[model samples]
Target: MKKSLVILITILLSAVIYGCSSSSEAENADNNTEDKPTLTLGQTNWTSTIVPTQIVKQILEDMGYNVEVQDAELGAVYTGLSTADVDIFMDSWSPQQDQYMEEYSDSIERISASYEDAGAGMVVPEYMEDINDVGDLKGREDIVNNEILAISEADPAMEDLQDIIDAYDLDMEMVNSSEGAMLAAAEAKIEEQEPVVLYGWEPHSMFQQLDLKILTNEKVPEIYGDTSIHVTVQNGLQEKAPEAYNFLSNWSISIDDMTEMITKIDDGQNSEDVAQTWIENNQDEIDNMKSN
Candidate 1:
């Protein structure tokens, strides 16, 4: 009887000790998670925005951060940053986005240019020989069915396009569409050697697969001229997340490289997988970004 009681007591004690250890381990895990910095990234609804934002999110996660991405329109992105509802934005075009910065100057700040001299403006296929300038399209609106292909209305580019129309007094109407749909329409036009004018920007896959030309007219002030894409964050990010701030301060990717990734992503590959592959292939570059 005594021996059986001792064995039973020993088993109960062992089970209690095991249960306590497991509970302690779970509590420690929760503590560790709580200790990590949680960051919110404000992502604009554009593939260009999606690509870099994911890359940065993954890099920060690798650096022990709890990162969350929140999608919003360009204007909402600025609002979120200003109010500190969002922590970072990886793709803000300089000078082009200067108005937003000026408005939120007190609450938001720019870290560095992710890529420089990014050309953005209206674009047309190389086959459109006669339609070389924006003014050339003033009277030739019938050629493109009096339509200018453009991305979402949520994009600030659409507003700029509207301003251009008002400035140049072009009769053509701006057609609103998603980037993928606009590209598809552009591709169909290109395949048939038809004329297509649409919003285009560098560090994009469209430039790689399609032979297009950016049009310029001195008649109106240049809105999309060469602009640097910047990494922007809320005002206190540098102090709140010093490590992340340093990494972003050193962030940059070649336009060619970004275009390649965009091409692969457009071809149906996963964005996270593409980013991971790029990170693996460019360890030295990533290391530098993480350092400063």
Candidate 2:
């Protein structure tokens, strides 16, 4: 009977020890998960936006973060950031996006300028020497088939283009299309050395692939103000992911480097691979970004 009692106590103690060990292991796993919070980054499909977002994504993942990328239109991207449905947005064109910023000012924070010399407006091939200004397109509707190739109508730049058309009384139609389609159209036109009017911005590979010029418009300086690309985030991102926030706050890339990475991406290279190559070559810059 004493032996039986001893055996029973041994079994109970063994069971208790096993249970405590399992519970401790489970708690450790939960703590590890809590320590590495999943970060969701908002991205637009534009190549300029994709390159930097992917670079930042890889950097954060290297820092032991579980990163999620959500691609959406500009409006939806902004809305997601504002509501904290998304944590970071790498590309926010200022002044042009000022209205959205104003609307979501209370929820979104502009982290830093990614690049400062970005320009957006009507662009024409250099061959079209006469088409140097928005007003220049007024009489050359036939050359462009009475069309102004542009991106989605949801874009604020599209609205600005419409206003420019009405303001200049250009007999041109704003043909709405995707960025890919617009660039394809512009490419086809450029190959033939033909004249085409399309929306253009810096930090894009097109400027490197083709000889193009951004047309000026004196009538709407406000719309075409000195454009600067910014990195924006949800209001709580700084406190929620301080490491990621610090990396982004110190992030800035040259127009030349961004354009080169964009060209690589446009040429069928994987964006992450392109980013990795850039990161490898730019360790000093990357280190600076993470210093604080």
Task: Give each model a TM-score.
Answer: 0.85, 0.87
Which residue pairs show backbone clashes in model 1? Answer: none
TM accuracy, model 2: 0.87
What lDDT does each candidate get? 0.87, 0.88
Model 2 lDDT, residue 190, Cα: 89
Residue lDDT tens for model 1, 1-292: 9999999999999999999999999999888777778999998767788889989999999888899999888899999999999999999987678889999999999988888988877899988888777888888888889888998887766788788888888888878888879989999999999888899988788876898888885676567766799999999898888889999999998888888888899889999999888888988999987875
Error of 2 at 249 (Å): 1.7
**Cα RMSDs, all models:** 3.7, 4.6
> Which portions of model 1 show Cα errors greater than 4 Å?
1-33
Question: What TM-score does candidate 1 reach?
Answer: 0.85
